[model samples]
Target: MNGPSLAIRQRSLGDLTAEFPLFPPLTRGCPKSSTDEIAYPLEVGYDYARVDPGLFDQTPGTDIARWSPLLPPLAAPTLGEGGTPLVEFEGIHFKDESRNPTWSHKDRLNRVTVSAALAAGAPGVVVASSGNHGASAAAYAARAGLRAIVLTSADSPPAVQAFARAYGARVVSVPAEARWPLLREVVDRLGYHPVSNQTVTHTGHPFGPEGYKTIAYELFLQLGQAPAAVFTPTGYAELLYGVWKGFVELKLLGLTGTTPRMFACEPAADGPHARALATGAPAAIVETFPSAAYGIAGPVGGHRGVLAVRDSGGEAVLVTDEEMRLAQRDLAGQGLWQELSGAAGVAGYRKLRREFGGPVVCVGTSSGFKDLGVGAQTYPVLEHPTLDDLRA
Candidate 1:
């Protein structure tokens, strides 16, 4: 993974201040400006001037760790998380992230964050997630020979719980509000790495989203140019910001003519990003309603997502549960079965049918198997019947 010499720094998303080192994995919300009302997330900043765009010209391999120059340096093990297929169906390009090792886009995030844990010499990794994040973190921790502890909601899907336990992670079912506070205690007492958000506002691990930048890099190489738009399912908007940052870097390196419009797709039941954008606020806390797309039902919005949407001339789009269900079925009809949240990008595209033209990319972020009620539907079966009986 050797490349040009690299130095990593932490920058505040609020004022673009480079005040912190990249190590120790900072996740605290950035300091707020006197004039501003809220603090922003800190981001992992690289010396992009030293990066060679030619390094990205090569077709991406199965290992995302190969993009080490753009990411924080760590000796993390790999499970072939990146290089997912970019398939076209119904006039849209789909980045099939569900094909990743852990069957979700969270695999990319955990790949780097777990590396941060190992680099910091932490005893283990801890995460609070209802589904994908916990499962992915647990698997990566196992790969790196570190203990894993996951705090999930008591009502988390059986499959997600099983997946984490299968990887030898200690899965604790706790109240929703208690997860973050408990994670903080674990980090303080046991010296474990906290991979998810612990702040009141969601400033996730600084190095985690760097793993998702590979999606934009892959899209460019696969299409030979940047698409007109990219729609991603948004929870904390980590993937949304990561993909947007990737394209921004390409333009900075004289590789792409223009960046795509980044769309942060969220469940309408709880669209904190959309609410923040609509209200002209740095962040928003929205009252949430139940939705089958539980994976993306984040109650709070973050500053990173707002920056991504505003900078890229993108907008936050909300899709209803029914819209997501229809989109999921449509993908299944085309032989791509995604979880309801994974289909939010497509649902958003449908909602904005008249807005954009030209090539568009929508990321299918996870597999259908991650959905809690995915297998509840069944069809009647008849035995000992002939073709006539079947027709009747």
Candidate 2:
């Protein structure tokens, strides 16, 4: 029950040369490589040698707090965020994150970020997301009794926006370009803790992805070892990197012999991760087009994502809207109605078209209810007729 963190410091992902203390978390990006104009993300560093080997012997519990030693200091109470099932569907493994409190994997990230806000004694948290991130931030901030501000675009999923507002968050609709700037002002001027990305190249909260590492721990427990490959639905590749980091920690602890290959699944319309890898950049920006899988169609890629694919010897695979649609339907056939973006992993896995010697996992990030237009259909009423009409 005592899951105190062993986190010591943070290292920059830009060049891995910059270092900073863990506490008073670097809400901004790496100071060495990041300026007001250019930004680079940082990774949390833990005193892994000090980690108790007995942690592996214990049953991986229902929430992220079970492995807090390997992560940053957790400051928020759990809303029952981890322990998602890794189910076999369509001849492959599917990590179902929809069972989380927010019906999305973002719950895991928020559990840590909101804790950062509470630890900093910040009054509220600010996030620039129109999807799961916004909703999850609102939910967790409310649970922690902190005010939340969600800045979204007008075209975001209606249900997702409703989720933020329903949680009593102050949701504001603004043009897409204005979100980050507004978020900056909220963080600096208004003194609100930013639970989302504030950097230009998508370095989210330093402690947020630490929350996502729990998924890998659960997978290791469920599968009895590391899988051969993990396919993640990536916007900034935070989940991809976090999962990889967990396995890396396991290997460092002399548990697993090797780590899984991390495959980042992104929308073809906006292949930030894929393009960033191709260019060998820490991060990159690309023009984006709206896709039904809106969650992973991010314009900016992150250093965390670049590190994940490259170090894991994995590649970024772009999935089309049609491909994801088929994958979504495929999951639905297996009784998992995931959001369109949630199907990116399976879509990427199928697109890879190579046989792996071991088990492969595709992450389903959210429920179908989080997608656009879930409850908007209006049905036509049938006219009253004779009882024989019913039989007909």
Candidate 3:
């Protein structure tokens, strides 16, 4: 099935002003209008006049690109990225995104961003990620027959590094602070389409988050109504913003009555979004400490996250490493093993004691195998096993 021919426009999040013809992914660090003071992630909006509501009624199946009227116009390469199972356990529904092709929610983002790279005629793609994002981007780029360069910190998980390399992507390890600068240099010199952020405030790829909207769409379709709240593990807040935007679009189309409250879950060691919200700033930077959930440990918070939380009447919640560990164990007991960072949503949900009174979804972003510490366990070795030892 082909998507409807729709014209794309770039709208500034700082102001309501929009510009036609989406060119140059990030204009001067972020999508901006002439009069905007704060630079924010440019929203990819469509001319709704050309859209037919009936088009959305078509079964999207596993490929999210099927909802093309609400997405950028491009032929995306899909590896069964979407249509993950929404499982219910202990009064909370879990959007198990670990079932994706790359075992992470990032496959949704990479599917669209890699297509953007192909549409723009870029040589390849470049991304900076410690784990899931890099692996997913490499997989998509490989599917599209394009070169992929993955930049990650030197201390990134070896399993994740191997996953990227297994997809035939060039993996480079650099200092945590040098990844972004090197990404920009590659984009400028090699003309590689950057699938990650290059700006100081972390305005991610324009087309990337649009893919995440499918999660919200799926939730509405499955439940036939909006949930009370959506808890998501946040780094740059791309998924949080994208999911909120999806709910807003549904309300705008009159398909849904209202949007759900969004919760941004971050590690307590580095809760830049929380800090930004407390300070009432568009963005904020903080010194990050080590945590078991390194995949979502971002030192800088972006304006996109703040907007999603504030607009949805939601708040940011910080979870400690211990809290996340407990949540991970809880998910495991429910037959869902998630990475420490992937369990942040559950941790946040537990931290917030308010009664939601309705269905609540916590996004499980990745599988437990992505964590570097997952492979360190060893079984006891015995020359002879006795009945007592077996019982013990």
lDDT of each: 0.87, 0.88, 0.86
Question: Ten consecutive residues with minimal summed lDDT in candidate 1?
Answer: 30-39
Residue pairs clashing in model 3 are: none
Off by over 4 Å in 1: 2-5, 31-39, 355-357, 376-385, 388-392
Best by TM-score: 2
At residue 59, give the lDDT of candidate 1: 88
Taking all chains together, each candidate's TM-score versus the true structure is 0.95, 0.96, 0.95
TM-score of 2: 0.96
lDDT of 2 by residue, 1-84 (tens): 457889899888876878888878787788888865457777889887788888877665567888888877777888888888
Candidate 3 regions with alpha-carbon error over 4 angstroms: 5-7, 18-20, 31-38, 58-60
Q: Number of clashes in every candidate structure?
A: 0, 0, 0
Model 1: per-residue Cα lDDT over 233-300, one tens digit each: 99899999999988998898889889999999999899999988888887787899998899999788
- Please write out the lDDT profile of model 3 over residues 1-392, one tens digit for every residue: 44663646777776665554576566334444322334577878877766677765755468886777787765567898888899997788999999999999998888888888888899899998889999999999999999999999888888899999999999999997898889989988999999988766767787778889989889988777899999999988999999999999888888888889999999999998999899998877888898889878978888889999998989999999999999999999999999999999999999996787688999999999998766768977977989998898
Error of 3 at 151 (Å): 0.9
